[model samples]
Target chain A: MDASKIKQGIHKSKGGLIRSFVTIENGAIKDIDVSGDFFLFPEEAFFKIIKELKGIPAKRGKIQEIIEKTYEKENIQSPGTEPCDFTESIMKALEDT
Target chain B: MNRWRFIDFGLVDIRDMMAMDEAILKGDEGNTFFFWTPKKSIILGYFQKAEVELNLANCKEYTITRRISGGGIAFSDDLGRQINYGVVGTIDNDLFPLDIIGSYKQICGVLIDTLIHYGLNAAFRPINDVVVTPYLNTGTKGARKISGNAQTRWEGKLLQNGTLLLDFDIEEMLRISNIPREKFLDKKIASIREGLTWLDRELGEQRDMEEVKGIMKRKFEERFNVRLKTGKLSEKETALTNSLLPKYYSPEWVFR
Candidate 1:
């Protein structure tokens, strides 16, 4: 199970549905893609979080911390969508059971 | 009454349409309302990946593009089958609510009134859609969406663009975009066909686009208590939009 495999998660955020597909290897994120019909202001800022997410332990606290920090640093405004929404989706992908 | 400029940028390339929207947001365009149609394209939400949301094999005939604002994926055509409109103003406009959902309610209220004036039973679904439900006898219970709207804020300004589905080709829409079963399942619908409605289908007749546009113009003025004077893009906006065009057409942007 530790061998890298793809998993998916979907969350209904305040903004809209957010879906994440993660490639996990050894209980850490090898690759992840967050996609959806949600709003994120200054969207160019998202790449920063994506770049930082790699290799982070696949846990709720650890995943959410990364997104929350990015939301603050980038002044992100994702109406109807929150940092935790992204966290929930990523975590679901990590712990899909 | 506060008067806002109304500009119609006749059918143009999708990239130009997006560039123009950004230019108006960044430049000193004052308060303006714009009506534009993109030459056939499937526009992706800001956060969506084309490969995830669209069927690339079916997209060869259409230009795949992304909008500066965030929202669901949608299709557009220059053949007068859809109506696209945007309101650009400093978020401080007296009637524009400062909060996101509040703003949608305010603007979509006008759209709801407009559609109702045409005898369509349009309603605003929270978050961001104008929808209409079929009569009970029709065997469809839930509201089906007819319009898609999204907003983006910058500095002190906000630009919101929404499209009203005066008409649509469901076959083409499904062909271009993958409507996952999970999307319509919550609504108790078996397919995207059941989850969507349009002006033509709801009314059983086509409303002349030009006539509908005229009525929509009046609805905005009436709803906001503002006069929308027919106008053209400002010199500053035109120049900036032209300058920004190259990036939109570049592969890095379209494919990025």
Candidate 2:
């Protein structure tokens, strides 16, 4: 799968768990949507985490870091899913950008 | 050159105490440490909007008062379950910056050292959380967060406080916060569980709350190497607390 294509799919998935992606284009983030069936806290936790990462110099890297940090701190588990893999996919997307 | 005070007022709600602290901060007169009441409450961050941050209906049902601290929201059930601490004095500007991370660690460090004394594995988590590990017989993974601290910095004085969860009701917490139930059902929520642990769980049934408070006070004194003078709010502080009470209790402040 082309990383960009996967990124585009993630950007379009919007809501309902699994996974989500927000694209950083021209120095601004665009296309924030979720894919897969994953559970997040506080409903606002996702937006809050995302908002906290906004306007950073390395937007993608920051997002990945925050997500992983929150996951580790909150003790969130996604069944058989691996957070590292998810992070790698996002990193791949960023590289393609 | 400073006396560290350890107050035991039982379980006072956050609103009344916050009002008292604010009055002292504004120089309304009396400044003292207090430990009062056995009430349960949730204090919102100073900059947080209560409506957006709390579930009003649940709070009303539970008789919890929102507080005036800036950071994340925390729930405290009673004096036994948690103890609140505040420091009021003219802090040297050069000693600490009035920033979030700076003040947070300073106060939390005291509790961290105290917990370590009990032979409990404790560490400070960023932003403002103290955690213990290995799930007190529940076989849970990750560091269990034992304490959550918040601070209010004004003028040259800093008032930092925290909730030491002797025991926590995780399910109730998820229900009270503005977060949805379904969201916490995911494996993500369990990961969060790993990061938190209660003192009661760690010590089993042999722990003493008063003894813990004494240990904390001793560590605080040792950390700052100051004598903690036992005293009550000055008449000025009481008056200030009373005057500010109406405002802090009003919808404008609570909802805002």
Candidate 3:
């Protein structure tokens, strides 16, 4: 459950599907990484959305709120692209801790 | 379709233009203006990590401000560098192709055609760059990159802005880019100038910046089939840009 350990795990899971991992140690996110294969759009574009999300401030008690806030920040309205579902996945990842 | 307004203010800050774009997207009164930075600066793509993309020492020594747009890093200085044109309007799905390839071909086609007017053989290279092939005997690929563009979509509007390097300092670019220094040690910098060229360089003299702007405006009008209207910054646009300028010029935004 060490923060460094979580960071390492997320960084190592650089597989093909668009996946994000948040490294939490002692109930606080220490690191995060979003990676995937060739996306319909540029990976850089998605990363930009993540960067904006990181700009917001959230308390440790508001983990789900943080995820939702970050997802809403992306503002992607393309057909079938659900930001809320994406946030759910991140919340699930955090809950796994 | 709304007519595109052209503002030709020379060497205005990039932050102002970005703020103006945001205001326009938010339905605030603002005129689309094209402005250039006076010093060499790296505008990191909106999503890029500034720490990863910019060299702090280099930017400070050279005095270039970073931009908020998304895409690869670009280095620019005032060697005939014209004001950057920002087209602000409602996002028209019809105007922008759904796919990246189609979009690149469409936007770059207009640029290539414009360059052809100046007698330079410019071509649209893949992944979103317009380049001219360097001469063979010159040991240059002749594929000099004349422009680099980036886009930002917000609310219901999209802003695509880029630069056309009229004349650039190769040494300054080499200092800022990810290219290794040793590679330029043995060859003339000009030889390696493939995928990069300037109108002034091609013409062997510094051409009038206003003339170049006129040509680009004409091309945009013809290709987009919209009249190019002349306008200045609206009061609301000016106020927004003024508000955003401090943050954009701040160390936090630049070094973030």
Candidate 4:
């Protein structure tokens, strides 16, 4: 399998049902979508958070930093999920299933 | 003493109802319970993709709308089979705890208690849902969902909304949503419905909407130790709803 090829995958959180879908190309997230029963405040932040991930490296540290910063700056409150949950989901999507 | 206002706006369209919720949360500072019955509509969550989760043709057949609240797909109809409940209030330390999940748990507890009062055992199924217990003596799955809930914090206030399914049109639901029957999506909807039980199904008979509302109001008062004063939408809230209705009914917002 080519590591840099564009790919799509889904990952449900380790501890919860929060799920994320990611489209990756050359180890970078090209697009993503999230949906679940989990609650995220400032409801508009749901789309904004996903937008912030575009073009970001798929590395865990980089993804984590971006998610945390976005949530903090936007005052987004997500119950049943943390910033690392999304970071890990994207990383898992990058991995071969 | 804790106090909450209970406002019943009767039947309304999805756009007006959703706008009213936001307006109350924006313009009011105290706790409020808003009630309304919506015409058949598929309410999508803020982050949900309409193309992937819903059947566009069916949505068109039976009007669809997107809500700003964060939650999974839910169906409601004005056939008196469901009651839409919305709670709007400031994020006050006095009314509820400051934690997000905690507040969800507390509100769901009230809902569960309401069901229990009706002799139908129910339980809170984390994040935001209430499920009724075993379908024993019947040939269906156990612990089915009777309620779906979601919330959002906007404009320094919290708006929590939920639907209590007194009855549901399963056929219509299957027709509208893209819930599959043999894959992951299948598993998702399967677990959701396997134990799904409605009020009429659980009670072995159809129950009137007023009866359900009366019991629910009493239950909330008992659980929260608050008085619920019957109220109506004020001029400010009504005006805001008018201004917000166009956006809610607009294609840009619904498809966004």
Highest lDDT scorer: 1
Ranking by TM-score, best first? 1, 4, 3, 2
Two-way lDDT contest, 2 vs 4, winner: 4
- Every model's DockQ, to 2 decimals? 0.64, 0.04, 0.07, 0.40
Superior candidate under DockQ, 2 versus 3: 3
Model 3: per-residue Cα lDDT over A1-97, one tens digit each: 3544543211111111223456654555555654321122332346555554453432333544654454556443322234443454455555554
Taking chain A of model 1 alone, its TM-score versus the true chain A equals 0.90
TM, every model: 0.92, 0.64, 0.66, 0.85
* lDDT tens digits, residue span B72-156, model 1: 8879754558889998878864677777788888888878998889876677777888888655524335788898998888888
Interface RMSD (Cα, Å) for model 1: 1.5
Instruction: Give the docking tier of candidate 1.
Output: medium
Query: Candidate 1 or 4, higher lDDT?
Result: 1
Comparison by lDDT, 1 against 3, better one: 1
Q: Is the docking of candidate 3 incorrect, acceptable, medium or high quality?
A: incorrect
Q: Which candidate is the best by TM-score?
A: 1
Candidate 4, pairs of clashing residues: B144-B195, B144-B196
Winner by TM-score between candidate 3 and candidate 2 = 3
Error of 2 at B49 (Å): 3.1
Angstrom error of the Cα, residue B198, model 2: value is 1.0
lDDT of each: 0.82, 0.57, 0.55, 0.74
Residue-level lDDT of model 1, residues A1-97, one tens digit each, is 2334678888777678788889877888888888889888787888888888999988889989999998999988777788998998887787775
